[model samples]
Target: MRHQKHIIAVFGGREADQKLLEEAEHFGQLAAEAGWIIICGGKGGIMEAVCRGVDAKGGISVGLLPEAKDIEANEYVGIPLATGLGYARNEVLALACHAACAFGGKYGTLSEIAHALNNQKPVAAVESWKIQGVHECNHAWEAFEWIQTQLK
Candidate 1:
């Protein structure tokens, strides 16, 4: 029997700063080193950063795109899944992953977090929202660790 690869959803703002982008990239790298695949919004900012880190580590990265156009996905995305659901694609991204991690984000990121939680999926946040059910972490490593625990 073969073990299933864990798919972790990474969520954040498209307009993230350098600091947040670096953190998201580090988080992706850590998760990839642990033999996990990454899923993200598939555009720019946090998504692009995470995908870049995953690609650097030779790990697969899937992007759930909001638009039907495949070109909308960032250059780092290994697989672009165009949902054509606009912002509603967040629900699909959350539902398709084993767990989720959130970085600093705005309304869209918060919605993804909520959707993940609503689906009973475990979520860890780093420099993100302070929701009651979400596990707060100081860094990506901590957030990834919490996600691992939830997956088990």
Candidate 2:
């Protein structure tokens, strides 16, 4: 059987500000409504917000966990894939999608963005402070629009 293509993966810090969370939710909802499967870290912060939005919209959300035995996925995740690779799995998550959106984040998010670009996956930033090699956007819809183009 042919598998459907998953579009964008959303990457951000495990802890984010409320404003970033709000933006992430909007991005997630729009992507989900477009039939895109949302992929995230399966933890807190922007990841939780996005997953919550996807779930509320009745959309598909896949969480690629950092650890198998000790990690806890966010409440909104629809599918959880536990990887014992820890931070190494971040690359796996970023690589699985055609594109990625990075919200406000820290070094981990920065690493994911770098990996995505290096792997040739286009990345869009929604409120993320300057991560090298990604197309930055102040608006969530703008990021989503860019991701849609990459998916096509």
Candidate 3:
């Protein structure tokens, strides 16, 4: 049995940024424990951290990927949906979520955040490189709690 309520897409850096990865994983775990489906880019860094956290907690996760490239999906990803549309497919992934959380990131994360906001999905930023939507704590736990409260 799966509890799929408002899938929360987490967007952040691909690089091995410690802060971003920690925050992403924390947020992903929190969301999963709270019974929300976790959605992500399905790659590395923030995405990998989040997926790992979700899996560790025995929660569900979805990887809305650009395409199934030579590389494989992250270990934590339960469902990998290859759009085959490249980065542009990010819009579809971001829009699919009822809400989105953005941590430290560059261009790709920024794009997902933009799409989520454009689609009216409540977007939250946790110590992001560029702040947008709701600004909250630097920690993912705090950010997730705030987002949950906002949705309620």
Top-scoring candidate (TM-score)? 1
Clashes of each: 0, 0, 0
How are the candidates ranked when ordered by lDDT, highest leading?
1, 2, 3
Q: How do the residues 12-54 of candidate 2 rate in per-residue lDDT, one tens digit apiece? A: 9978788889999998889889989989888889999999989
lDDT of 3 by residue, 1-152 (tens): 98548788888777857767777887777888998898888887888899998987888898877875625678788788776778987798787888888877788877888888778888788777455565556788878987897677
Q: After superposition, how far is residue 127 of candidate 3 from its true place, in Å?
A: 2.3
> For candidate 1, lDDT tens digit of each residue in 93-139?
89999999999999999999999999999999989999989999998
- How high is the lDDT of residue 49 in model 3? 94
Error of 3 at 49 (Å): 0.2
Sorted on TM-score, highest at the top, how do the candidates line up?
1, 2, 3
Question: Candidates' TM-scores?
Answer: 0.96, 0.93, 0.89
| C-alpha lDDT of residue 31 in model 1 | 86
Better of 2 and 3 by lDDT: 2
Of models 1 and 2, which has the larger TM-score? 1
**TM-score, cand. 3 vs. native:** 0.89
